[model samples]
Target: MALSTQYADEDSQNVLIAKLDNAKNVSNILKAIHFKESATVFASSMGLKVTVEDSKCVQANAFIQEGIFHEYAVQEDQVTFKINLTVLLECLTIFGSTSAPGVTTNLKMCYGGYGCPLQLVLEEDGVLTECSIKTLEPDEILDFNFCSENVINKIIMKSECLKEAFSELDMSSDILQFLMSPDPPYFRLSTFGDAGSTHSDFPKDSDMIESFSCTQTQTNRYKVSLLKPSVKALGLSTRVSIRTDNRGFLSIQYMIKNEDGQICFVEYYCAPDEDVSDPYS
Candidate 1:
Protein backbone atom coordinates (compact mmCIF):
# COMPACT_ATOMS: atom_id res chain seq x y z
CA MET A 1 0.00 0.00 0.00
CA ALA A 2 1.08 3.53 -0.67
CA LEU A 3 2.42 5.26 2.43
CA SER A 4 0.33 8.40 1.94
CA THR A 5 -2.98 6.60 1.37
CA GLN A 6 -2.37 4.16 4.18
CA TYR A 7 -1.29 6.69 6.83
CA ALA A 8 -3.30 9.70 5.63
CA ASP A 9 -5.96 9.67 8.34
CA GLU A 10 -4.03 7.81 11.07
CA ASP A 11 -1.37 10.47 11.68
CA SER A 12 -2.81 11.36 15.07
CA GLN A 13 -2.89 7.72 16.16
CA ASN A 14 0.69 6.94 15.28
CA VAL A 15 3.13 7.16 18.13
CA LEU A 16 6.09 6.84 15.77
CA ILE A 17 6.61 7.26 12.03
CA ALA A 18 9.86 7.27 10.10
CA LYS A 19 10.70 7.29 6.41
CA LEU A 20 14.04 6.54 4.84
CA ASP A 21 15.25 6.87 1.28
CA ASN A 22 17.20 3.64 1.56
CA ALA A 23 16.21 0.95 4.01
CA LYS A 24 19.64 -0.63 3.82
CA ASN A 25 21.10 2.16 5.96
CA VAL A 26 19.02 1.11 8.96
CA SER A 27 19.39 -2.60 8.23
CA ASN A 28 23.16 -2.34 8.00
CA ILE A 29 23.48 -0.61 11.37
CA LEU A 30 21.04 -3.01 13.08
CA LYS A 31 22.97 -6.00 11.76
CA ALA A 32 26.05 -4.99 13.70
CA ILE A 33 24.29 -5.61 17.04
CA HIS A 34 22.24 -8.64 15.98
CA PHE A 35 23.89 -10.90 18.52
CA LYS A 36 20.57 -11.39 20.33
CA GLU A 37 17.29 -12.53 18.85
CA SER A 38 15.19 -9.93 20.68
CA ALA A 39 15.78 -6.21 21.26
CA THR A 40 13.98 -3.36 22.97
CA VAL A 41 13.32 -0.30 20.81
CA PHE A 42 12.97 3.22 22.21
CA ALA A 43 11.76 5.94 19.87
CA SER A 44 11.46 9.68 20.40
CA SER A 45 11.89 12.92 18.51
CA MET A 46 15.67 12.65 18.84
CA GLY A 47 15.86 9.24 17.19
CA LEU A 48 15.52 5.50 17.75
CA LYS A 49 17.61 3.42 20.11
CA VAL A 50 17.55 -0.39 19.92
CA THR A 51 19.12 -2.29 22.76
CA VAL A 52 20.08 -5.98 23.11
CA GLU A 53 21.39 -7.54 26.28
CA ASP A 54 22.75 -10.92 27.32
CA SER A 55 23.59 -12.82 30.54
CA LYS A 56 22.87 -9.54 32.39
CA CYS A 57 26.57 -8.85 31.99
CA VAL A 58 26.75 -7.28 28.52
CA GLN A 59 24.55 -4.79 26.71
CA ALA A 60 24.64 -3.38 23.16
CA ASN A 61 22.88 -0.28 21.87
CA ALA A 62 22.40 0.94 18.27
CA PHE A 63 21.55 4.60 17.85
CA ILE A 64 19.92 5.85 14.65
CA GLN A 65 19.67 9.61 14.91
CA GLU A 66 16.57 11.45 13.60
CA GLY A 67 18.76 13.28 11.11
CA ILE A 68 19.29 10.05 9.20
CA PHE A 69 15.62 9.74 8.42
CA HIS A 70 14.00 11.74 5.67
CA GLU A 71 10.86 12.16 7.73
CA TYR A 72 10.58 11.40 11.44
CA ALA A 73 7.67 12.04 13.80
CA VAL A 74 6.79 10.92 17.29
CA GLN A 75 3.52 11.87 18.92
CA GLU A 76 4.70 11.06 22.42
CA ASP A 77 7.81 11.96 24.35
CA GLN A 78 8.92 8.35 24.34
CA VAL A 79 7.55 5.12 22.86
CA THR A 80 9.03 1.80 23.87
CA PHE A 81 8.48 -1.79 22.78
CA LYS A 82 10.24 -5.11 22.48
CA ILE A 83 10.81 -6.54 19.02
CA ASN A 84 12.34 -9.57 17.33
CA LEU A 85 15.40 -8.20 15.58
CA THR A 86 15.72 -11.19 13.29
CA VAL A 87 12.19 -10.72 11.99
CA LEU A 88 12.63 -6.97 11.64
CA LEU A 89 15.82 -7.38 9.59
CA GLU A 90 14.18 -9.87 7.29
CA CYS A 91 11.36 -7.45 6.65
CA LEU A 92 13.71 -4.55 5.99
CA THR A 93 15.61 -6.50 3.37
CA ILE A 94 12.62 -8.23 1.79
CA PHE A 95 13.51 -6.93 -1.64
CA GLY A 96 17.15 -7.96 -1.48
CA SER A 97 20.13 -7.72 0.79
CA THR A 98 22.42 -6.04 -1.71
CA SER A 99 21.94 -2.68 -3.37
CA ALA A 100 21.35 -2.40 -7.11
CA PRO A 101 22.99 0.32 -9.14
CA GLY A 102 20.84 3.47 -9.19
CA VAL A 103 18.11 1.65 -7.31
CA THR A 104 17.12 2.16 -3.69
CA THR A 105 14.63 0.48 -1.42
CA ASN A 106 12.45 3.04 0.31
CA LEU A 107 11.11 2.33 3.78
CA LYS A 108 8.18 3.73 5.78
CA MET A 109 7.79 2.48 9.35
CA CYS A 110 4.85 3.22 11.63
CA TYR A 111 3.59 2.30 15.09
CA GLY A 112 0.04 3.02 16.25
CA GLY A 113 0.30 3.59 20.01
CA TYR A 114 0.57 0.53 22.27
CA GLY A 115 -0.60 -2.99 21.40
CA CYS A 116 -0.21 -2.25 17.71
CA PRO A 117 1.93 -4.26 15.34
CA LEU A 118 4.94 -2.41 13.94
CA GLN A 119 4.18 -1.66 10.30
CA LEU A 120 6.82 -1.62 7.56
CA VAL A 121 6.35 -0.54 3.97
CA LEU A 122 9.12 -1.05 1.46
CA GLU A 123 9.05 0.05 -2.15
CA GLU A 124 11.64 -0.45 -4.86
CA ASP A 125 11.23 -0.15 -8.61
CA GLY A 126 7.48 0.27 -8.14
CA VAL A 127 7.35 -2.92 -6.06
CA LEU A 128 5.71 -2.44 -2.71
CA THR A 129 6.00 -4.96 0.14
CA GLU A 130 4.20 -4.51 3.44
CA CYS A 131 4.90 -6.19 6.76
CA SER A 132 3.40 -5.99 10.25
CA ILE A 133 5.54 -7.56 12.94
CA LYS A 134 4.11 -8.08 16.41
CA THR A 135 5.65 -6.12 19.25
CA LEU A 136 6.01 -7.40 22.80
CA GLU A 137 5.83 -5.54 26.09
CA PRO A 138 8.94 -3.52 26.76
CA ASP A 139 11.65 -5.10 28.85
CA GLU A 140 13.53 -3.26 31.57
CA ILE A 141 16.84 -2.26 30.03
CA LEU A 142 20.02 -2.38 32.07
CA ASP A 143 21.95 0.69 33.12
CA PHE A 144 25.67 0.20 33.60
CA ASN A 145 25.84 3.51 35.52
CA PHE A 146 29.07 4.15 33.65
CA CYS A 147 29.95 7.84 33.85
CA SER A 148 32.89 9.91 32.62
CA GLU A 149 33.77 11.03 36.13
CA ASN A 150 34.46 7.42 37.08
CA VAL A 151 36.50 6.57 34.00
CA ILE A 152 40.05 5.63 34.89
CA ASN A 153 41.34 5.02 31.38
CA LYS A 154 40.07 6.12 27.98
CA ILE A 155 41.44 5.60 24.46
CA ILE A 156 40.18 6.63 21.04
CA MET A 157 41.69 4.93 18.00
CA LYS A 158 40.99 3.85 14.48
CA SER A 159 38.89 0.71 14.35
CA GLU A 160 41.31 -0.95 11.95
CA CYS A 161 43.81 -1.35 14.77
CA LEU A 162 41.45 -3.20 17.12
CA LYS A 163 39.74 -5.06 14.30
CA GLU A 164 42.92 -6.96 13.52
CA ALA A 165 43.52 -7.76 17.17
CA PHE A 166 39.97 -8.99 17.73
CA SER A 167 39.96 -11.02 14.55
CA GLU A 168 43.10 -12.85 15.62
CA LEU A 169 41.91 -13.40 19.20
CA ASP A 170 42.24 -16.94 20.47
CA MET A 171 38.88 -18.63 20.76
CA SER A 172 40.40 -21.12 23.19
CA SER A 173 40.79 -18.32 25.75
CA ASP A 174 38.01 -17.98 28.28
CA ILE A 175 38.90 -14.44 29.22
CA LEU A 176 40.39 -11.40 27.49
CA GLN A 177 42.66 -9.25 29.58
CA PHE A 178 43.13 -5.51 29.10
CA LEU A 179 46.05 -3.56 30.51
CA MET A 180 46.28 0.21 30.36
CA SER A 181 49.07 2.19 31.95
CA PRO A 182 51.04 5.40 31.59
CA ASP A 183 54.36 3.57 31.42
CA PRO A 184 55.73 1.24 28.76
CA PRO A 185 53.37 -1.19 27.02
CA TYR A 186 50.76 1.54 27.41
CA PHE A 187 47.86 -0.52 25.98
CA ARG A 188 47.83 -4.28 25.70
CA LEU A 189 45.40 -7.10 24.88
CA SER A 190 46.21 -10.51 26.32
CA THR A 191 44.59 -13.92 25.99
CA PHE A 192 45.60 -17.00 27.99
CA GLY A 193 44.47 -20.21 26.36
CA ASP A 194 45.49 -23.88 26.37
CA ALA A 195 48.49 -23.34 24.10
CA GLY A 196 49.86 -20.28 25.83
CA SER A 197 49.35 -16.58 26.41
CA THR A 198 49.31 -13.99 23.63
CA HIS A 199 49.77 -10.27 24.03
CA SER A 200 49.30 -7.44 21.53
CA ASP A 201 50.47 -3.99 22.54
CA PHE A 202 49.96 -0.51 21.13
CA PRO A 203 52.28 2.32 22.03
CA LYS A 204 50.68 5.41 23.55
CA ASP A 205 51.96 7.58 20.70
CA SER A 206 50.87 5.30 17.86
CA ASP A 207 49.45 7.18 14.85
CA MET A 208 46.28 5.09 14.99
CA ILE A 209 45.47 6.39 18.45
CA GLU A 210 43.59 9.68 18.33
CA SER A 211 43.37 10.19 22.06
CA PHE A 212 44.85 8.53 25.14
CA SER A 213 44.16 9.47 28.73
CA CYS A 214 45.14 7.23 31.64
CA THR A 215 44.96 8.48 35.19
CA GLN A 216 46.56 5.34 36.62
CA THR A 217 47.55 1.81 35.70
CA GLN A 218 44.59 -0.55 35.42
CA THR A 219 44.27 -4.18 34.39
CA ASN A 220 40.88 -5.85 33.99
CA ARG A 221 39.63 -9.13 32.64
CA TYR A 222 36.39 -9.77 30.72
CA LYS A 223 34.80 -12.92 29.45
CA VAL A 224 35.81 -13.65 25.88
CA SER A 225 32.31 -14.87 25.01
CA LEU A 226 30.59 -11.70 26.20
CA LEU A 227 32.92 -9.29 24.41
CA LYS A 228 33.08 -11.27 21.15
CA PRO A 229 29.79 -9.95 19.84
CA SER A 230 31.13 -6.40 19.88
CA VAL A 231 33.53 -7.31 17.09
CA LYS A 232 30.63 -7.04 14.69
CA ALA A 233 30.19 -3.39 15.50
CA LEU A 234 33.90 -2.85 15.49
CA GLY A 235 34.14 -4.29 12.01
CA LEU A 236 31.67 -1.75 10.64
CA SER A 237 33.00 1.32 12.40
CA THR A 238 35.68 3.75 11.30
CA ARG A 239 36.75 4.78 14.80
CA VAL A 240 36.16 3.49 18.32
CA SER A 241 36.48 4.78 21.84
CA ILE A 242 37.41 2.35 24.64
CA ARG A 243 36.81 3.40 28.22
CA THR A 244 36.90 1.75 31.60
CA ASP A 245 35.56 3.00 34.91
CA ASN A 246 37.19 2.76 38.33
CA ARG A 247 34.96 -0.25 39.03
CA GLY A 248 36.54 -2.04 36.02
CA PHE A 249 33.43 -1.78 33.85
CA LEU A 250 34.23 -1.58 30.11
CA SER A 251 32.52 0.63 27.58
CA ILE A 252 33.21 0.57 23.83
CA GLN A 253 31.63 3.09 21.51
CA TYR A 254 31.89 2.68 17.73
CA MET A 255 31.47 5.51 15.25
CA ILE A 256 29.71 4.21 12.13
CA LYS A 257 29.20 6.15 8.93
CA ASN A 258 26.23 5.05 6.88
CA GLU A 259 25.89 4.98 3.09
CA ASP A 260 24.61 8.54 2.98
CA GLY A 261 27.60 9.85 4.91
CA GLN A 262 25.48 10.15 8.06
CA ILE A 263 27.02 9.15 11.36
CA CYS A 264 25.48 6.57 13.73
CA PHE A 265 26.79 5.06 16.93
CA VAL A 266 26.78 1.53 18.37
CA GLU A 267 28.01 1.05 21.92
CA TYR A 268 28.66 -1.94 24.14
CA TYR A 269 28.82 -1.96 27.96
CA CYS A 270 30.31 -4.95 29.78
CA ALA A 271 30.96 -5.79 33.40
CA PRO A 272 34.34 -7.11 34.38
CA ASP A 273 34.75 -10.79 35.24
CA GLU A 274 34.75 -10.89 39.03
CA ASP A 275 35.93 -14.45 39.38
CA VAL A 276 39.44 -13.62 38.25
CA SER A 277 41.86 -12.14 40.77
CA ASP A 278 43.74 -8.95 39.92
CA PRO A 279 46.99 -10.12 38.38
CA TYR A 280 48.59 -6.67 38.77
CA SER A 281 47.92 -6.63 42.50
Candidate 2:
Protein backbone atom coordinates (compact mmCIF):
# COMPACT_ATOMS: atom_id res chain seq x y z
CA MET A 1 0.00 0.00 0.00
CA ALA A 2 1.15 3.60 -0.59
CA LEU A 3 2.39 5.53 2.43
CA SER A 4 -0.30 8.19 2.00
CA THR A 5 -3.07 5.64 1.73
CA GLN A 6 -1.73 3.58 4.62
CA TYR A 7 -2.13 6.56 6.92
CA ALA A 8 -5.17 8.14 5.26
CA ASP A 9 -7.61 6.26 7.50
CA GLU A 10 -5.37 6.68 10.55
CA ASP A 11 -5.24 10.38 9.87
CA SER A 12 -8.98 10.67 9.94
CA GLN A 13 -9.10 8.58 13.12
CA ASN A 14 -6.08 10.27 14.69
CA VAL A 15 -6.41 11.74 18.15
CA LEU A 16 -3.97 14.51 17.42
CA ILE A 17 -2.96 16.42 14.27
CA ALA A 18 -0.51 19.28 14.15
CA LYS A 19 1.05 21.26 11.28
CA LEU A 20 3.89 23.75 11.16
CA ASP A 21 4.70 26.26 8.43
CA ASN A 22 8.41 26.14 9.21
CA ALA A 23 9.81 22.93 10.68
CA LYS A 24 12.85 24.79 11.96
CA ASN A 25 10.75 26.48 14.62
CA VAL A 26 9.94 23.16 16.26
CA SER A 27 13.37 21.67 15.54
CA ASN A 28 15.13 24.58 17.22
CA ILE A 29 13.05 24.31 20.37
CA LEU A 30 13.46 20.54 20.59
CA LYS A 31 17.24 20.99 20.44
CA ALA A 32 17.12 22.97 23.67
CA ILE A 33 15.81 19.93 25.60
CA HIS A 34 17.59 17.16 23.67
CA PHE A 35 19.79 15.92 26.49
CA LYS A 36 17.86 12.65 26.62
CA GLU A 37 17.37 10.30 23.67
CA SER A 38 13.72 9.54 24.48
CA ALA A 39 11.07 12.12 25.35
CA THR A 40 7.46 12.00 26.46
CA VAL A 41 5.08 14.01 24.28
CA PHE A 42 1.73 15.33 25.51
CA ALA A 43 -0.85 16.84 23.20
CA SER A 44 -3.78 18.99 24.25
CA SER A 45 -5.81 21.89 22.99
CA MET A 46 -3.41 24.27 24.72
CA GLY A 47 -0.35 23.01 22.83
CA LEU A 48 2.33 20.30 22.66
CA LYS A 49 4.82 19.59 25.45
CA VAL A 50 8.02 17.60 25.05
CA THR A 51 9.71 16.45 28.25
CA VAL A 52 13.21 15.05 28.83
CA GLU A 53 14.79 13.91 32.05
CA ASP A 54 18.21 12.86 33.36
CA SER A 55 18.71 10.51 36.36
CA LYS A 56 15.30 11.59 37.71
CA CYS A 57 17.20 14.48 39.29
CA VAL A 58 16.75 17.02 36.53
CA GLN A 59 13.84 17.61 34.14
CA ALA A 60 13.38 19.86 31.12
CA ASN A 61 10.22 20.80 29.23
CA ALA A 62 9.81 22.43 25.81
CA PHE A 63 6.45 24.06 25.14
CA ILE A 64 5.12 24.73 21.62
CA GLN A 65 1.70 26.35 21.76
CA GLU A 66 -1.08 25.66 19.25
CA GLY A 67 -0.85 29.26 18.11
CA ILE A 68 2.58 28.47 16.70
CA PHE A 69 1.13 25.81 14.40
CA HIS A 70 -0.67 26.63 11.18
CA GLU A 71 -3.18 23.88 11.94
CA TYR A 72 -3.74 22.13 15.26
CA ALA A 73 -6.44 19.69 16.32
CA VAL A 74 -7.03 17.46 19.33
CA GLN A 75 -10.00 15.15 19.72
CA GLU A 76 -9.15 13.83 23.17
CA ASP A 77 -8.76 15.52 26.51
CA GLN A 78 -5.11 14.40 26.59
CA VAL A 79 -2.92 12.24 24.37
CA THR A 80 0.38 10.87 25.69
CA PHE A 81 3.13 8.90 23.99
CA LYS A 82 6.88 8.32 24.04
CA ILE A 83 9.21 8.56 21.05
CA ASN A 84 12.90 8.79 20.30
CA LEU A 85 13.52 12.52 20.23
CA THR A 86 16.72 12.01 18.28
CA VAL A 87 14.75 10.30 15.52
CA LEU A 88 11.94 12.83 15.59
CA LEU A 89 14.40 15.74 15.36
CA GLU A 90 16.19 14.08 12.48
CA CYS A 91 12.90 13.51 10.65
CA LEU A 92 11.77 17.06 11.27
CA THR A 93 14.91 18.41 9.60
CA ILE A 94 15.39 15.67 7.02
CA PHE A 95 15.15 18.10 4.11
CA GLY A 96 17.90 20.37 5.51
CA SER A 97 18.54 21.89 8.90
CA THR A 98 20.44 24.99 7.89
CA SER A 99 18.78 27.98 6.31
CA ALA A 100 19.07 28.61 2.57
CA PRO A 101 17.94 31.60 0.58
CA GLY A 102 14.21 31.34 -0.28
CA VAL A 103 13.97 27.83 1.11
CA THR A 104 11.81 26.55 3.98
CA THR A 105 10.43 23.23 5.20
CA ASN A 106 6.79 22.58 6.03
CA LEU A 107 5.67 19.82 8.35
CA LYS A 108 2.48 17.83 9.10
CA MET A 109 2.45 15.54 12.14
CA CYS A 110 -0.25 13.03 13.01
CA TYR A 111 -0.69 10.41 15.70
CA GLY A 112 -3.26 7.67 15.58
CA GLY A 113 -4.62 5.79 18.61
CA TYR A 114 -2.31 3.83 20.93
CA GLY A 115 0.55 1.65 19.59
CA CYS A 116 0.74 3.51 16.28
CA PRO A 117 3.88 5.17 14.95
CA LEU A 118 3.98 8.93 14.67
CA GLN A 119 3.33 9.96 11.06
CA LEU A 120 5.25 12.91 9.68
CA VAL A 121 5.16 14.64 6.28
CA LEU A 122 7.79 17.17 5.32
CA GLU A 123 8.04 19.41 2.26
CA GLU A 124 10.81 21.71 1.20
CA ASP A 125 11.43 23.58 -2.05
CA GLY A 126 9.03 21.28 -3.95
CA VAL A 127 10.45 18.12 -2.36
CA LEU A 128 8.38 15.91 -0.05
CA THR A 129 9.66 13.49 2.62
CA GLU A 130 7.64 11.13 4.80
CA CYS A 131 8.68 9.45 8.03
CA SER A 132 7.05 7.07 10.49
CA ILE A 133 8.67 6.80 13.90
CA LYS A 134 7.54 4.03 16.23
CA THR A 135 6.15 5.21 19.50
CA LEU A 136 6.88 3.46 22.79
CA GLU A 137 4.66 2.92 25.80
CA PRO A 138 4.38 6.02 27.95
CA ASP A 139 6.40 6.23 31.16
CA GLU A 140 5.38 7.91 34.39
CA ILE A 141 6.80 11.45 34.50
CA LEU A 142 8.01 13.26 37.62
CA ASP A 143 6.16 16.18 39.11
CA PHE A 144 8.24 18.95 40.69
CA ASN A 145 5.32 21.16 41.75
CA PHE A 146 7.60 24.17 42.06
CA CYS A 147 4.78 26.70 41.96
CA SER A 148 4.93 30.49 42.38
CA GLU A 149 3.39 30.39 45.84
CA ASN A 150 6.23 28.16 47.01
CA VAL A 151 8.92 30.32 45.42
CA ILE A 152 11.09 32.08 47.96
CA ASN A 153 13.38 34.01 45.64
CA LYS A 154 13.01 34.83 41.96
CA ILE A 155 15.14 36.89 39.58
CA ILE A 156 14.70 37.79 35.93
CA MET A 157 17.88 38.65 34.00
CA LYS A 158 19.18 38.92 30.48
CA SER A 159 20.55 35.68 29.06
CA GLU A 160 23.84 37.42 28.31
CA CYS A 161 24.73 37.63 32.00
CA LEU A 162 24.00 33.97 32.76
CA LYS A 163 25.54 32.83 29.49
CA GLU A 164 28.96 33.99 30.55
CA ALA A 165 28.60 32.39 33.95
CA PHE A 166 27.53 29.06 32.46
CA SER A 167 30.26 29.12 29.80
CA GLU A 168 32.99 29.77 32.33
CA LEU A 169 31.64 27.23 34.81
CA ASP A 170 34.33 25.01 36.30
CA MET A 171 33.60 21.47 35.25
CA SER A 172 35.78 20.30 38.13
CA SER A 173 33.07 21.45 40.52
CA ASP A 174 30.82 18.68 41.82
CA ILE A 175 28.03 21.01 42.94
CA LEU A 176 26.77 24.44 41.96
CA GLN A 177 25.57 26.55 44.86
CA PHE A 178 23.00 29.32 44.61
CA LEU A 179 22.52 32.09 47.16
CA MET A 180 19.71 34.60 46.91
CA SER A 181 18.67 37.18 49.43
CA PRO A 182 17.14 40.61 49.80
CA ASP A 183 20.25 41.78 51.62
CA PRO A 184 23.79 42.03 50.28
CA PRO A 185 24.84 39.40 47.77
CA TYR A 186 21.38 39.77 46.31
CA PHE A 187 22.10 37.09 43.72
CA ARG A 188 25.11 34.76 43.67
CA LEU A 189 26.26 31.62 41.89
CA SER A 190 29.26 29.73 43.11
CA THR A 191 31.24 26.71 41.99
CA PHE A 192 33.92 25.09 44.10
CA GLY A 193 36.63 23.15 42.32
CA ASP A 194 40.24 22.01 42.59
CA ALA A 195 41.32 25.56 41.77
CA GLY A 196 39.25 26.75 44.73
CA SER A 197 35.93 28.55 44.24
CA THR A 198 34.48 31.03 41.75
CA HIS A 199 31.54 33.30 42.45
CA SER A 200 29.39 35.34 40.08
CA ASP A 201 27.14 37.93 41.68
CA PHE A 202 24.48 40.11 40.08
CA PRO A 203 23.26 43.25 41.80
CA LYS A 204 19.49 43.42 42.10
CA ASP A 205 19.46 46.94 40.66
CA SER A 206 21.77 46.13 37.76
CA ASP A 207 20.52 46.66 34.22
CA MET A 208 20.82 42.99 33.53
CA ILE A 209 18.32 42.15 36.26
CA GLU A 210 14.87 43.14 34.99
CA SER A 211 13.01 42.09 38.15
CA PHE A 212 14.09 40.88 41.57
CA SER A 213 11.74 39.70 44.31
CA CYS A 214 13.63 37.95 47.06
CA THR A 215 11.79 37.83 50.34
CA GLN A 216 14.19 35.73 52.41
CA THR A 217 17.76 34.55 52.39
CA GLN A 218 18.07 31.09 50.88
CA THR A 219 21.02 28.90 49.83
CA ASN A 220 20.90 25.57 48.03
CA ARG A 221 23.22 23.16 46.24
CA TYR A 222 22.54 21.09 43.12
CA LYS A 223 24.60 18.63 41.13
CA VAL A 224 26.59 20.51 38.50
CA SER A 225 26.23 17.66 36.02
CA LEU A 226 22.46 17.88 36.04
CA LEU A 227 22.12 21.64 35.50
CA LYS A 228 24.74 21.69 32.71
CA PRO A 229 22.14 20.70 30.10
CA SER A 230 20.38 24.02 30.57
CA VAL A 231 23.26 25.77 28.85
CA LYS A 232 21.76 24.75 25.52
CA ALA A 233 18.63 26.74 26.27
CA LEU A 234 20.62 29.62 27.74
CA GLY A 235 22.71 29.99 24.60
CA LEU A 236 19.65 30.33 22.39
CA SER A 237 17.59 32.43 24.78
CA THR A 238 17.22 36.21 25.11
CA ARG A 239 16.03 36.28 28.72
CA VAL A 240 16.18 33.90 31.69
CA SER A 241 14.22 33.62 34.93
CA ILE A 242 15.76 32.02 38.03
CA ARG A 243 13.62 30.88 40.94
CA THR A 244 14.19 28.93 44.15
CA ASP A 245 11.32 27.60 46.20
CA ASN A 246 11.01 27.24 49.97
CA ARG A 247 11.91 23.56 49.70
CA GLY A 248 15.28 24.42 48.06
CA PHE A 249 14.02 23.30 44.65
CA LEU A 250 15.37 25.30 41.71
CA SER A 251 13.64 26.28 38.47
CA ILE A 252 15.18 28.11 35.54
CA GLN A 253 13.13 29.39 32.60
CA TYR A 254 14.62 30.49 29.29
CA MET A 255 12.76 32.72 26.84
CA ILE A 256 13.88 31.90 23.29
CA LYS A 257 12.97 33.91 20.18
CA ASN A 258 12.66 32.03 16.91
CA GLU A 259 13.67 33.27 13.44
CA ASP A 260 10.14 34.66 12.96
CA GLY A 261 10.50 36.70 16.16
CA GLN A 262 7.96 34.50 17.94
CA ILE A 263 8.73 33.69 21.57
CA CYS A 264 8.97 30.15 22.96
CA PHE A 265 9.95 28.95 26.42
CA VAL A 266 12.20 26.18 27.75
CA GLU A 267 12.39 25.39 31.45
CA TYR A 268 14.53 23.23 33.75
CA TYR A 269 13.72 21.90 37.21
CA CYS A 270 16.25 20.36 39.62
CA ALA A 271 16.07 18.66 42.99
CA PRO A 272 18.55 19.86 45.59
CA ASP A 273 21.38 17.59 46.63
CA GLU A 274 20.51 16.79 50.21
CA ASP A 275 24.06 15.79 51.09
CA VAL A 276 24.69 19.48 51.52
CA SER A 277 22.56 21.09 54.16
CA ASP A 278 20.57 24.21 53.39
CA PRO A 279 22.13 27.18 55.14
CA TYR A 280 18.73 28.76 55.66
CA SER A 281 17.32 25.60 57.24
| Best-matching candidate per TM-score | 1
Give the per-residue lDDT digits (tens) of candidate 2, residues 77-152. Answer: 9999999999999998787656587678989999986999999999987788989999999899999988889999
Residue 239 displacement (Å), model 1? 0.1
Per-residue lDDT tens digits of candidate 1, residues 163-266?
88876778568899999998889999999877778888989999999999988899999999999899889989999999999999999999999989999999
RMSD of 1: 1.8
Question: Model 2 Cα displacement at 272 (Å)?
Answer: 0.6
Which candidate should be chosen as best, given lDDT against the real structure?
A: 1
- Against the true structure, candidate 2 reaches a TM-score of 0.94
Pairs with backbone N, CA or C atoms under 3 Å apart (clashes), candidate 2: none
Query: Can you give the lDDT of residue 118 in candidate 1?
Result: 97
